[model samples]
Target: MSPLHRLGLATARHPWRTVVAWLFALVALGGLASVGGGEFQDNWNVPDTRAQAGVEELRDHLPDAGGSSAQVVLHDDHRLEAAVVHEVVADLRSTDHVTTVTPRLSEDGDTALLYVRYDVPTTDPAIYEDISGLEHATDAAADAGYEVEYGGELPGTATSLQGRGELIGILVALVLLVIAFGAVLAAGLPIATAVGGLAAGSSGIALLAGIMDVSTSAPTIATMVGLGVGIDYALLILTRHVERLRAGDAPVDAAARATATAGRAVLGAGVTVLVSLMGLRLAGLPTYDAFGFATAIAVVCVMAAALTLVPALCALAGRRLLPRKERRAPEVSRLGAGAPRSSTTGIVETREVKEPLTARWATTVAKRPVAWALLALTILLALGAPALGMRTWPQDGGSDPKDSTTRAAYDLVADEFGPGANGPITLVADLDTVDRAEVKQVHADVAGLPGIAESGPVTYSPDGKLAVWDVEPTTSPIDERTTDLLASLRSDVLPEGVDATGYTPLLSDISDLLGQRLWLVVGFVVVLSVVLLALMFRSVVVPIKAALMNLLSIAAAYGVVTLVFQHGYGASLLGIDHAVPVSSWVPILMFAVLFGLSMDYEVFLLSAVHDDWLDTGDAQGSVVRGLSRTGRVISVAAAIMVAVFLGFASEPAVVVKMLGVGLAAAVALDATVVRMVLVPATMTLLGKWNWYWPFSSVVEVRGAPAPSLETSDDERDDLEEVAR
Candidate 1:
């Protein structure tokens, strides 16, 4: 027996031991996490950008002003008392890691702004603690009858994973499972394995956070992927095991065979997902690297659970995995049309065998392949049209919930001051290299720029080697016009020695970097996926076709996201008040993730089709049989994925919401239009060419006798003609 078969047999024979071991591992990991886990932080430090150089220059020459900063906005019906503002400033100054606190009152006298700067990088865990202390200090203002809120990098540096989305996704998955399997025990097996894997994977991410800069969103993203794939892999294996039971195999043997077959496909699919995710590293951003690493860890844990825990559960469930009617009926020969021999139940009523709906649908497509292909293509292209106008920017405080302190602070700052006040572009120059006269001239030019609302006097470092200029734009941080202004400043206004660095300008730099590298990541993922598919199927045409179809589905999903989130098509329904650019990192991350996920269905369907083709030597017949056999399972699996993803789509974070919607849309399209209609139609048209291989000699082509069918002689003849 193969190693996978042996593994399956061993686990099924000792189900209790397997279950106990998994439980122990989960507990141990959880314990380790609780003890060693670190707080999550966002890192947008792009190394090669002009913004990064500017930051480095500041850090080298001006230690006091080189750290991250945030704003405390206080509002009252009357002018703020000087004593109260002084007390708040003293409190902030005493906060840990706080280096400077500057207070300014609005001309209207109703609002006050405190600038609090910390002596640590925004990615440091201490920064979160600092924000907490700042918030606590600002609470005194609230006690004095003033409304207070926080804004800027320090306040917006954290990403939260807290939401009802994950729970809802799991519940929806369980419901879908029960409906699909027709037995609670069988359905629960997948859920149990999935949850076990998710718990362990989440714990693993916590541990990973201690060692590296893991983003707070990593755990949530990991959970989203791990839960979906964990359930999916287990379900695939369990389905095969139950099929084997119906075919009269012993529980151990059935589980072993199922593992040898379906488990192989799961292994391939899992590896593909891992490889695709790792492609995120190529983007050369620390945040993207963290995303790739954290999510990959989750996928690995879940895949291992599916491969090992699923067989044990299947063996334990035994005949209970089958439906009530199937349990009472005698084992029917799956290879031939045979009457039931006997039954445990006294009444052995027989029912006519009708053709499966999937099989009939396949036959219809085969009859008019060209029309079906055209219809699927047109739908995909139309859905993908909106992608042409897609725009992307990094998430800003403005995207936070309306009630959130960060959002309130953002709005207050924009209202009290100009909108540009919220995102001041800092210009740093090395006085040793650039003349002070030239620096002054650059400042004057920037002030006269079209988008410039205000410009501050140049402040020289104590060492006299560094000078900094602050310029406020006439637009919000995420505004395209702000980006244009920054570009003009870099390209025309600012001289070579002056570098722009601030929250807004830094995010713009990061967005530009991601946009430039997006195509390279796509190419890497697509080419690698194609090669993997070709190796698995041993057919050139199959992999190419699979890649093309997957691309179409992804494009359609992108279009949907652009329309809903960027164009405000249905933004209100998702709680978004206005159109916003898609998150800059989302499309790159989504492409890597969705491409791998789309492959799961491809492997599931193509593996079955390849097996059927090897068995019958009739290409068209195999396509019909494969679809008939796996269509329901694939559809249910896709539905579960959709439900899980849609759950996350309802999250408050726009980036998370965009990713959730994009992934869900792609899966829905891939499973429906691509898998059901397009795949069958295209395969029917390809005929014998679908199996063409340059190295066919290495593959064993079986010429076994065709299996007996439930169809009438006339129907069989028609199918054979279509196959020819």
Candidate 2:
């Protein structure tokens, strides 16, 4: 027996022991995570970049310039009083995390802005608490008829929607599973296994957090992937178990066989996901690296649960796994009143007696291979067309929910001072000599630039060797206009002695860096996936076809994201108020995730086909047999994933929403158009060449028979029965 069969038997033999052990591990890990898990760091550390160099210089030379800053905007219909403004500024300066506070009164005096600098990055929990308290301190201005709003990283960090996205996803998945399996017990087993896997995975992320700088978004992303794939992996295994039970195998023997077959597929799919996620590390961004590791941990945990816990549950449930209604006798019609009536019912008779529509569709596609293949390719290509115009930028306060304080503050700042006031570019200069005249001239030249809204007075370091000036732009932080301004300043406008180091410029630099490195990362994942698929399937053409199809699916997903989020095609439907650039890290992360997920269907369908081909040496027969066998389960699994992913579409965070919508669309297209139509059609056209290799002659010379389309009708009938 294979090791997977051995594992299933071992788990089945001692179900309670396995259950108890998993429960104990979950509890212990949960407790440890609660106590020792470190905070997530939003560290966008891009080494050997100009931004890093500038930041390091400031941190080393100027104490007050090292940390992040927040903005407090006060608005009133009437002219604001100087006294009240002073009082608010004094209160802000008194806050524990506030290092310095600078107040600016609008020309009309109806608005006031206070810039408060912090001693640490805004993602620090302590800094967030301090900012919250500062907001309360500023409440007195609001009480006095002045509208108070908080902006910048503080409010943005504090207002993340943290409720029930995962829970809702799981509930939706459960409903889909119930509908697919038609058995509450059968459906619940996958969910149970998923929950256990998620518990362990989440705890593992927490432990990793304690040791490294994981991103704040890692847990949410990990949860989304872990739950969807966990349930999917278990569902596949359980479906096979049900098939074996219906075939009249004993419960333990059925579980072992199912595990040996479906469990191997699960392992391959999980490893594909892991490899894709780990490819994020090649992007050379800390956030992506952390995301990769955290997600990989979750996948590993879920894959293990599918292998061990799912089989244990299957063994414990036995024939009772199927719903009672499904297991009961079916009503058969009598051909004639005079004829002797016989009531004959078995598991398959009571269940779906006719072949599924998917089987018929596969047969039709196989008959017209070229046309179906072209149609599938056309659909995917059309969907992916919009990706050509995709843009990337960091999400800012403008993308925050309108009700959030950050959004309010952003609007007030834009309405009063300027949109650029919310995101200013600071110039830090290391001078050979303290020449006030030269610094003043440099500031004037910067202010005269095309996109400049205004410029702050230059402030020099105590030793007078360094100077800093805040240059406000005429657009929002995430606007392409602002990026253009940053580019001109860095490349054309700024003097040789000066360097830009501010939130807007830093974000632009990060976006550019990610965009530049994106291709390398994509190439790595594609090549890695290709090599892995080639080795597993032992065919170059199959791996190449799979990789290309996966890319097509991912591109379609990107195009959807571009249309909805970038072009505002369906922005309102998804609750987005306006079009925004795709988040810089989103496409890279999405590619890794979607490629791996798309492979899940490919692996499932092709592995079954390969097994059939090894037995019968007929490629076309194997493709039909494989599709007819795995199509329903693949459809059900894909539906579960789509439901789970789209469940998070309502997330207030635009990034999360993008991920949700993109993943859902990708999975839907991949499972149906690509898997059902394109794959079988392509294999039909290739015939025995589908499995050809340069080394085939050597194997053939060693007395191995060549693969041939010599399968008998009896063998086809048996395969069809097995599929059913």
Candidate 3:
């Protein structure tokens, strides 16, 4: 027997032992996480990049100006007193994390801006707690009839997830499973397996946090992937077991057969996902590496649970897994069949059947392969057109929810001072000499540059070798104009010795680096996917076709994200009130995730087709049979994924919402348009060439005749056995 069959038998025969083992592991990991798990670190430091070099230079040459900074915007309908501003600045200086606080009054005398610097990075979670005292101080100023708002990364960091959306996603997944299975136990088993997987995966991430800098977004991304695949893998195996039980097979035998066949598909699909996620390391970004490791761990835990815990649950429930009506029906007609006939012994006799809708659809596509293929391609191309116009940048306070204090402060500053007041570019100069007249001349030259709103007085380091100038832009931080301004300053405006470094310049550098590396990451994932699929199916054409189709689906998803979020098409529905550029890292991350996930359907369907092709040696017949058999299961699995992903669409963070919506769309399109329509049409057109490789001559005759749909009872039994 295959190892999968043996595993299923072991779990089935000793359900209690398997259950206890899993429970013990889950509890032990949870305890370990609670006691020893370290906090998540959002380390945005990209090494060897301009941003890193700038940061290093500042820390080395000007230690006092090397920390994360925020702006406190105070406004009063009446004239603000200078004494009150000084008091507020003093209170801010006394805050635990604060290193310095400097206040500046607006010319109108009604607005005050206080620049506060912290010893820690903006992405550090500790800054949030430390900012509480500053918030309290601001509250006191507010009581004195001034409006206090925080404008910068500090307020943005305070918007951590409430986790309600994740719960809702699971609930929705449960509902979809119930609809798919029609029985409570059968529906609950996948959810149980998924929940167990999620617990283990989350705990693993927490433990991993202690060893390295893991992004705060890692948990959410990992959970999204883990739950989707966990439920999917279990569902595939459970569906096969049900099919076996509906036949005349014994419960244990059915479980074993199901695990051997469908479970193998699950295993293959899981490996593809793991490979694709781990390929994120090729992006040469640390955050991507952290995300890759965390998500890969989640996928591994969930896949293991699906292979073991799911079968154990199935064994424990036995026939009780189905409803009473289904269990009592001794010889029910096969799925998608018309009706059962009464045998002479009063036992109902049934024949193996195909889903009429999916079968007819497949036949139709097979008849006019070119038309159907072109139609699917056209739809994808149309959906993907918007991607060409996509713009990417790191998320900032300007993109925060309107109700957030950071956003309010950003608007306040933009209104009173200038839009660029929220993000000022800094010039760090290694001066030949620190002469006051020469520094003044340098500041004057910078102030005369285009797009410069105002340039502050040059501040010299204590050692008197480094000089710094704060130059505010005329546009918001994420504005394209601001990016152009930085480019102009770097190439034309700044003197030879001066270097620009600040939030704006760092983000700009990061964005540029991402754009350059995006292709490398894509090429890595594509090449890896092609190689993996080629080896798995042993067919060059099949992998190439699958890769192209997956890219189409992902591109379509990107276009949808751009249209909705960037173009403000459905932003309000997803809780985004303003249009924002896609997050710089989101496209690469989304591509990795979507490629892996779309392959789930690809592997499951193609594996079935390959099995059918080998059995009958008839390419067209295999396509029809495979589609008819796996169509319903794949559709249901896609539905579950879509539900889980879309559930996170209401996430407060725009970046998270972008991921949720993009993933949901990609899965939906892949299952329906790509899998059901494009794949079948293309494979039908390929005929015998679908499985052709350099070694095709050794396998079989090149022109084997296609078989008829009907077959003898023995042949039908063989087909059904293989299908399981």
Per-candidate Cα lDDT values, in order, are: 0.84, 0.83, 0.83
Backbone clashes under 3 angstroms, per model: 0, 0, 0
**Global fold similarity of model 1 (TM-score):** 0.93
Each candidate: RMSD to true structure? Answer: 4.4, 4.6, 4.5
lDDT of 3 by residue, 1-724 (tens): 9999999989978889999999999999999998888898888777766656767777877765777888898999878987778778888888877888878788889999898888777776777524576787676687788888887766667777767667877788788878877888898899899889989999999999989989888998999889999999999999888877776566787788789888899998998898789778877778998899999999999999999998888888888777778887764434424544321011134454334587788888899999999999999999999999999998898888888888888888888899999899888877773455666777898798778899897888787778887999989988999999888877876666677888888888878888888888889888988998998988889999999999999999999999998999989987678899999988989998999999899999998888777655667778987887788889989998998888877778888889999999999999999998999999999886788767544343223322223345565455444432
Question: What TM-score does prediction 3 earn?
Answer: 0.93
lDDT of 1: 0.84
Clashing pairs in 3: none
Give TM per candidate: 0.93, 0.93, 0.93
lDDT of 2 by residue, 593-633 (tens): 98899888899999888876765555687788788888999
Which residue ranges in model 2 land beyond 4 Å of their true spot? 34-36, 329-353, 433-437, 698-724
* lDDT, residue 464, candidate 3: 73
**Worst 10 contiguous positions by lDDT, candidate 2:** 337-346
Q: lDDT tens digits, residues 171-234, model 1?
A: 8988988888788888788888988888888888889888988877788888888888888998
Provide the lDDT at 236 for model 3. Answer: 93
